[model samples]
Target: MRYESIVRNTEFSRAYRRGKSYVSPFLVTYVLRRKRGGVRLGITTSKKIGGAVQRVRARRVIREAYYAMGLNEEQSVDLVFVARTATTRVKMQKVEKAMRAHLTAAGLLSR
Candidate 1:
């Protein structure tokens, strides 16, 4: 599914930093907030995740996992996904699993 438009605005990025509520595990860290159509997912992977290839893979895994879960509701929500160092050693399935696990824990997944 296509996600909503997300721009690199200082406000949105800062809001995430200021937000107290967040979900973090050994694999990823995420923050969710209500926005206006579907959820907009933003991913962050530092240089610590290895090189650009590994970072891109991590991002693709998370995005694909989100798509697979079928959370394409009209309710607007912003999700920021941060990759942890451990993500470098894990496979795509594990990355997807972590994404699903975090989303479920956040009550973003009900079905």
Candidate 2:
């Protein structure tokens, strides 16, 4: 199933206020259980990461990593992936690994 994007500022705020977070060298993930079915994903990169190009790259990397994980459709959660400055310099494999680790820790991965 395709994951929906969490586009509203309030949605991000809610997740930040009520979610559990996991931090790695490259990424910080916030997971909030939602009453709605299916998963929603949000990605954010701060200016500290770099200019527009670097920030966009960081968001793309995070998005690709989440897509690579192949999460099941039954998960009912909202996820926010926050990119750190390190993300712009890290390899894709490391980013994917970090995403998996965080998802597993949050019990979102079926296996």
Candidate 3:
């Protein structure tokens, strides 16, 4: 499922500055609550991940893993997914599992 994306640099900054962070070898997530809006998503991968091809693949994998989470577009949250070096080396299922653990710990998986 497609999500409302967090695109602007300011929005990304706001999430980084104010959101709660969940970190694992597979991924790093920042979650911020939105009082009245649907869920928004952002994904980031650095040069440390590799070249253009690898970065794109990391993004694609994270996106697919996120879709597999079955989250609705109507949730009251904003989520940022940062790909760690390990993210590109694992299966989508492993990424999904890590994402689930982080979200569950943040109490965002209850819905």
Tens digit per residue, CA lDDT, model 1, 1-111: 777645686635764675434454535544456655567767777898889998887777767766777774776577777777776666667767777777677677764
**Residue pairs with clashing backbones, model 1:** none
Which numbered prediction scores highest in TM-score against the true structure? 2
lDDT of 2 by residue, 1-111 (tens): 478999999999999999999999999999999887999999988899999999999999988888888998887999999999999998888999999999999999855
RMSD of 3: 1.3
TM-scores for all candidates: the values are 0.76, 0.96, 0.94
Off by over 4 Å in 2: none
- Each model's lDDT comes to 0.67, 0.92, 0.91
Q: Better model by TM-score, 2 or 3? A: 2
TM-score of 2: 0.96
- Measured on C-alpha atoms, candidate 2 has an lDDT of 0.92
The true-structure Cα RMSD of candidate 1 reads 2.5
Residue 41 accuracy (lDDT) in model 3: 94
What order do candidates take by lDDT, descending?
Answer: 2, 3, 1
Greater-lDDT candidate between 2 and 3: 2
